[model samples]
Target: MTGIDPAVRHLTRTAAQMRKKKPMRIMLLAHSYWPEHSPPQRRWTTLIREFRKAGWDIDVVTPVAHFPQGRRRLPRSEAGTPFRGQRGPFGERIKRVPYLRHSGNRHAARLVDQVFSAAMSIPTALMWRKADVVIATAPSLPILVAGYLVARLRGVPLVVEMRDAWPDLARDARLVKGQVKSVVERVVEAIQRRADLVVTVTDGFAQTLRARGVKNVVTVTNGLDLEAVQLLEAPPAERDKLEVLYLGNHGESQRLDVIVKASALVGGDLMHLHMVGHGTRRPDLLKLAGALNAPVTFHPPLYGADLIARYRSADTCVVSLRDDWKSFETTIPSKTYEVLAIGRHMTAIVRGEAARIVTEAGGGDVVAWKPEAVAELWAELARDRGRLTAGLSGRDWVKANADFRQLAVQYMGHLSDLVVAGRSRP
Candidate 1:
């Protein structure tokens, strides 16, 4: 018999070992889940699919589909409504709980709804009697409390995944202040202390958590799900006019107003700016674009293949940040990875860690937030489009470093170790 390929052999052994061991029952607590096109939902959906394939029993407890935009009723099956129990892909189960749908633009109103939803999720999570481990993801930090209580009650490990630094981001955005900021910080820290594993999406976030005395922190940066994004053949470097695109959340941190101001400052027939995706700031941005008479088009959000096509059509992908916000320095937008995966050049109006990544990766130019600076860069790129077309190398870099399959494998190993450790504890 010929020897098997090393990779195949390793996979075979791993599969057999997984089958031999008791199947891990994992409960995921998030305020959002699949069918909501938000980043947290998409990230966890991909992770849950991989976990199910790896022979784990996955149960997701989330609020009904309502985010960025308000809730829409989805079709239900004869078996039951999705709110009761929905069978997700690969036999993974999802349980949607009740929550008030608040408008995204009002921060205080949104927080109230999230806190109420988080409280409702605790009882729903307790219903999953088979769960051996629990993971709580936070853009909504209240869910971490639910996960902590569930884990404590069931004698299982609680894994807290920080997609953003929560109250820090809120404070930086001026959504929280003074005593409110201190109280929020205390609550977030207390939740962090309860977790057996603290997973952060950025190294900067992990460092911040460590400084705040959180233990067992690990950085698992957001990456491209290579399987989902079908990279198309690169269009010619030469085009009739430049098309600059900014896709993904248009929230407070994005500072998309800078992009609009830049478009107005650089008013010419040579280039047009496109902003896609729905968020609290979309209406304000639309109004700004109109007031400035900028050559900017706003498109409603697209998903799956339609979103990929939009990326493929772009001459350059623009990423923006509010320069005044210190917390934003730590956020490496997931869109960065997506743009690189689609082999598109990036122009980032950012600083600190995000700028460092764009610069070091050779993905594209990192410009200051000033309209004059951005206009100048756009003019240069319009003249020599090759500067914006040199993204094949960036694509290669992403494939090598940020493939989701590899990250999923590493994540599973981490979770398995946590399970073993939890089992041994008194």
Candidate 2:
């Protein structure tokens, strides 16, 4: 106490007091969980770790390990057996639900799998130990339904996390369309209205929801475990050809076709593009690249040290979304934050909020969504190698905005306030 800073001492005392209280319990509903390399899993894994340090209890209801490939690959112990609750490597408890076996890339099959698992999740969550709040994270939409039902029956505040700009994205993609308003849109908005809180990953989406009169929306954007992500070493000075890397989904929203075409337009001898991940559009992108003889390599996903090594190998990283879609105006790719944190130059093929963040960070330049434009930018970047080493501006932005430690604390406040207010209601 004598040598410690007063703030540190105060915090230590507060932490001790917090430990003495009954831990606030949370039941989270999701289509993915730990050991699965999905976006929701990554976001929640870091948050749950922080929650545990603060002495909170979390119970996760999820389907078995089946993502990208759409069938279980891990042993039951790691994936968790259906109807059995297993302790997570982090401090939370995970209750598994059965999933439908399907091909990873089949749309109808994936939808069926999501529906089956979501239905099973409702019962799994309802039978769990009591919780103060129930959180439903969407990437799998039916999980939102299960979350709402479970919260209502259990009589707790429901927090629906719309990770993407949903209903809007659905409309943009035309997943559902009617003469007036589709049933999908109605169902999503209804759930948003009924939920005690709506958590959006981007402030733009939060504002959008509020404009539509859903009053309880809050933005908790995707973030990094900064303490764990190192500032990557710069690319080699004597490189033969500049390498631009895109690591994440190879899906339509990315319009990766443009990227492949741009790489071909540059000619394989000048530069190379490495796209690492699985998605519905990956095979098509491969075919296009082959047809054009593009200098693009599509690799399966890399994680942990391998992912960092991939980042280290790149002179520039790409954070792209199709510019034609209005819903994307609010979408920020999770990897954008990662690229910024790791201190890489970017080719941000995005607009609105995502482009603004990149521009503000001074990490890189945003190019037009054209093959010739992208190819021209790459040529310019290649000619001026110095442009590829944007300094700590991006990292600084992440520290100020997207660090998970800070985000988790902000989220805890929201959960605590809701839990208190919820109990006080009639």
Candidate 3:
């Protein structure tokens, strides 16, 4: 043992310490899981893989994969299996429950599906062996409720991971109003109160939860998976016409119609706008773009190598948010991180945290919904293409701060602390 290299010795000691205590079994409750192409699934999948590698026994409970497009993706043979258990990546066990499939881009329809999935997940979770800690990933309220119930029943600490602000986001988007908004706010508050720890994707979100009187909130911002980062090819050669890409969900919150309007403002032979992804608002956006004679081309979503290729092919990526919506101010779109990781220039049409990061990093220009301003920025970029390739401080910042391994370590430490504290209580 003494002959072992110092680094190896340190690693052995760390592994032994991790094994000194019985392996912690962590149950993750998420409405969407592996085989789904959504951001939340990607984030959790990477984290779960890391947790497993670190010797934690991680079990996942999720509905059959269906997201963004809202069509069930299970194999025909597995479609009828209401409650099926199978080994997932990294030796983690996964429980798939039946859920009502609905378009995730539509708020009301997605909420209905979430409720049904949550209902089915509760019983499935209760039947599982007790976990040391339960983590509920939520942009959906029902999943949080189910997680709370399972944690309570299992007598374990509950950790609520907020991917979005839920009721607050809905209310800001005007999707929930009047008495419905009041009720949702109350329910969200109640859910937060039940959580032994709250994990959020943004510091802004953590602050919002703290203001609502929820204690023990931690920010674990979305990060780039290093393995995926390594797979990205170098940015492709500049295209004949500057290809400006907007890749992500075309939901109401995204206010992608603003992009259409901006496209109309900048109609020229030298610029082309590519809008990729599916959403409830895609038809509306398409119709508006056609009516305005905007130079925008719409494409279905791409994943894996295809998506990375799309990024490489673009000179700039556009990210937008509804300017009037306060709830979105807290959001740092995962695409922003992706673009930075790929070292592509970006145009952030947003406010608050997202804008601050872009501005501070000098990643790209930040513009409002003003069509003229957006057009001006695009024209400027078109004239000075060098601006797109100049500074890479943003990419470097993300690589240094938002690496997945670093984020996973931070997340695991939080979970470990929570588990230890829970064990010490009573």
Candidate 4:
């Protein structure tokens, strides 16, 4: 017994051998990555950080960071190199591809950029070490095509992440003009069916995809790294007026005009809405605010302490999705979980899954999307400040349902199951 027990020695050897086994390798294709803090960046960055923590290797195939229009993040020297891999902060191997510069014609230009970048992604991904799986996330549809082709050529299982209600959204928005059945819808659906696993950000969308006969699907809702997100103290209720915040994009999908008109109705003397971030609609919103004389302050997008400062100064955060689009019912703004995690009351202008989340959290009221209804809610909140105390319900909701730590584990299990299943198939 004094001489090292044989069974204990055997167990130790087995443990060492397991540690020496190869870690899972994942090749991720997306429109954005680290150093660019957008919706996709936030979700994937947090998830990828957790994946790296688990000792998995992630290879990112993306184009030069030229998002948010009017701002190209990386310089020419740093960005446009094809087949040249750089290590990210999270240890991800970032392989950069060139992007197409656009004129004022944004929609058509951006599509061209996506197409160009997606084509480049193939060569970039193929040059990297072989991966066990290929994951392609989409709000940018062209990337899905690239992901499919790469996975096929490389002989790997493909995971297609539908971050938004794509084909439905395209039809709803009429992204393709003058056609009942557009090429865009057909391509998206074809890729969806062909993918090994279709992952949706909302359970509602996952259900929709399943109903459409997509074979394999899963739900991995957008979440934050709880430990990284600072929970600020709720604002004091003794103020003479209310301070409302809308910190995300100023896009058509948000229908921010309603929020502006609501603030106008609330009157500058009683309350003010702080609209932050930039988008195609910011200029129009500025003009609308000027015309209406709304008590709205527009700020360019802020990050780090600046962002947290704005959150601390707010009574409620606005999470909006246009109600007219049927597909939007299944969409949840990426900012929803962040607001909940940070314990802010929400003016949730949404329906369906997103509405259910806000109500369930007790952190906010799901108001009707109309300016009159939103204005009424604000007027009521201004009168009854006690309702502004969001309590810990929202934060609690995030911990249970939207924490990336838990969600990442779920993701790992999903990936493991898919990889194993792929290997097991004839």
**For model 3, what is the alpha-carbon lDDT of residue 13?**
66
For residue 297, model 1's alpha carbon misses the true position, in angstroms, by 0.6
Tens digit per residue, CA lDDT, model 2, 271-356: 99999999999889989999999999888999988998899999999888998889999999999999999999999999989999
Query: Could you say which candidate leads in lDDT?
Result: 2
Q: TM-score: which is higher, 3 or 4?
A: 4
Best by TM-score, which number?
A: 2
lDDT for each of the candidates?
0.80, 0.88, 0.81, 0.87
- Looking at model 3, which ten-residue stretch has the lowest summed lDDT? 230-239
Going through the candidates in the order shown, the clash numbers are 0, 0, 0, 0
C-alpha positional error of residue 295 in candidate 1 after TM-score superposition, expressed in Å: 0.3
**Per-residue lDDT of candidate 3, residues 292-392 (tens digit):** 99999998988877887788788889988878878888988888877777778888898899899888777888998777788788878777787787256
Clashing pairs in 3: none
Q: Model 3: residues >4 Å from true position, as ranges? A: 1-22, 74-80, 103-106, 230-240
Displacement of the residue 88 alpha carbon in candidate 2, Å: 0.5
Q: For model 1, what is the error of residue 341's alpha carbon versus the real structure, in angstroms, after optimal superposition?
A: 0.5
Better of 1 and 2 by TM-score: 2
Q: Which ten residues in a row have the lowest lDDT in candidate 1?
A: 73-82
Q: Which is superior by lDDT, 1 or 3?
A: 3
lDDT of 1 by residue, 236-261 (tens): 67887778999977888888888888
Q: In model 3, what is the error at residue 91, expressed in angstroms?
A: 1.4
